[model samples]
Target: MDLDEAFELVGEFGPRQKRLTAFLVLLQVFVAFQSMLIVLVGAVPEYHLDLEEIPASREVLAKHVRFASNFTSIATEWYLIKHDAYKVSLAASLYFAGLLIGNIMFGPLSDKLGRKPVYLTGIFFDVIFGYVSAFAPNYEIFAISRFFVGITNGGMSLVSFVLTQEYVGKSFWALTGSLTNLTFAVGIAIYALLGYYIREWRFLAFISNSPGLFFFLLSFMLPESPRWLYSQGRTAEAENVLQYIALGNGKERLSVKLKQCIGAVKKDDSESGVLSLVKHPVLRWRTVILMYIWSGRRKSTTAFLIFAGIACIFTMCLPENRGGFFFSPSILALCGKLTVSAAFNIIYIYTSELYPTVVRNAGLGVCSMTCRFGGILAPFVPSLKTLGPSVPFVVFGISGLSAGFLTLLLPETLNKPIAETIEDLQTSTYQMLKNKKVNQLEENS
Candidate 1:
């Protein structure tokens, strides 16, 4: 009896498992909601500065013409000029900064602390900071609030994601993966609709942040990761959780499952620290490749939508004088966005499946922190208009393309057993692939 047997006895894709996965999928929706809410929450309405006299000549356009949104952002309250990209998008940038910090810190913490506690703590802060941002008196305070929200989002999201993947069978990861894409799409569409209906920024903030509360409440219902418990040499608790799972799953003879778990439990020889990722030999190359993907920042389903948005913006607003071209920049941009998004979704799912359980969170965290840096830079992209509108898009496009090519270097994990330890990942997977090649050659002979 081994770990694989333990997973089997628990009943893969059983009613209990599906029920839990559904709830977890629901939570992923809110996580999607929380992440994308920023795009619309501070939509600034257009406005104009008071003019004592209208400008007679076009040369005076800079003085009289003030660029503004139809709805003023909550931060601006009054008016902001077009060139002030920092003021307009700084909160989002700061939030990404917080996300970066969260990614760096939470992975190791969760590995040390167990997934549930750190995850719950993140939810607590997520719930608290979420609402607090609505009442922010100034842009600076709002930025700080949003930053903390980003931190909780990054930390909890990583841990919770691992837990979600762990609870279900490997074959069903695709189902869960589809749920991730759907929720992301749903989150974006719903937020857009909410923005259209809701006029006040603070009201929108409250409405958007309300979902965090549900997650915190649901935190009580979530089971601690049995795998994490086992890894930490806590078989009693692991057995208890397994029993609970067996009962919920309507499987008979919990004793057999317990025996399997006991047989699988051992001294955790795998290095679980964040540094272990770079220090270990096989893991080092894996980390480097992962970092490349991270830097490319997962140009997937959700991200491509963002690119499509940029394309749409340019399509409507492209200068009338540039009508000589058959296809406008915006249309081209939109197509690129769609392609990138689909590719990203595929790559990101593959990334999650590649790492073993012990260091999965850590690997994901460091990788996502790299992504946050990209996020941090992303908000500032509008500022690049000073150089040229197409400059930013080109930069991002190159980044996405490079990442896709690098992703080919990674091994496929579809339907394969997810490794539970570094040794299992480095040694077992290596041998597994080696034996597979040998068997193929023997068959050919």
Candidate 2:
């Protein structure tokens, strides 16, 4: 019997899995905090020039004026400069860039080193860098610190998510994944509330980064993914972990069944990597489609709607500028957010299910990397109003619709055993293609 069969014996979504899922899901809150922290810290607060401080000389015409405000941020702490727009944008962009880099580096590392260690290392450094960012003396240092924080965020987020999926049975995949994302949404809300009350950016940063320390301590309880262990031919260790889980679930007798099943398990010693994903016909198209869906559907739709909504409401919805209640851009924007948020939850679970175990993290990393491009580009989307008010929304809407239609090409993974090897994935894909062709032949006849 294989890992899936062993899971059947041990019990899926048992008390042990529930406890583990809760811990893992809680970690997502901190990730969300780090991901959205820049919105507050790098915010440009309202300020007016102190005309008295300005030198009235022809040679000093280009000099920046002294500005004063009650609000404290990277923007206001340092006087706004001529290139303030580019500098602020860079600070935000660098974090996403770090996220991109982190996904590229850590995804493969987790596949090679195992999930728990990579995740822990990520959390440790994330806390370290979070503190560094909070205390950064200059805007340059703060921006650089945020970049490293983004790197750690990418690693922790990806590994923790993959670890969550691996711990549960196929039946709980969607439910647990969606639950974790709900926590992320909650985190974003909490961050907004915190930002509202905490006027100083440094204080807010300190408070936001403080949770990582607690999460780091809690992470000690996380176990290595048994599925990953089994795929790597560490059957003895995997069985030991499963036995522990079995005991937790009060199915101690199932440990004996796992012992028997382990003897029959054949180890596949083939090496797998990111490149392997595209080397096969079955995996190549699937990878392409999944990447496109992640980049366009998951990232673009969500980012565009959220940013566009904020832009319209703030810029166009003054009391004098308000439109009809039902047909208002604000109402339409909220609906768009609701639609995309649901899609975000589903795509994460779906992507995790599509890839096989060996290259799962690597494949996810690449897809996640693509998704960051949308994030990196999202802020500038609001600036596209110079072209047209509806341009950004239309672009995102079309991309989302196209990706929604393409999802039909993906095989349904619900209630199916997770693929443990590339061979297993290929065999399943072959069977699916064969069935499709046969059905088409019958129709032609």
Q: What TM-scores do the predictions have?
A: 0.78, 0.83
- Supply the global lDDT for candidate 2: 0.77
Q: Can you list the residue pairs that collide in candidate 2?
A: none
lDDT of 1: 0.69
lDDT of 1 by residue, 1-445 (tens): 3344577878766777777777767777667767876677655545574566655543453456554654435534523344443565777667777788888888888877788999999989987998888888766777789889989987987787777767766666666766766676777777788878886778888888888797788778888887777666676787777777788888766664333222232455454668778887777887887776666522233345345444545554566457556456645665766665665555556666776666778887887777776655666777877897666765665666565566566676654666666666545666866765787799799
Residue-level lDDT tens digits of model 2 in 268-309: 433566777778677788889888877762233344434434
Off by over 4 Å in 1: 51-72, 76-85, 258-271, 297-335, 378-401, 430-445
Note the Cα lDDT for every prediction shown. 0.69, 0.77
Best by lDDT: 2
Candidate 2 runs further than 4 Å off: 52-69, 256-271, 297-332, 380-389, 429-445
lDDT of 1 at 384: 77
Best by TM-score: 2
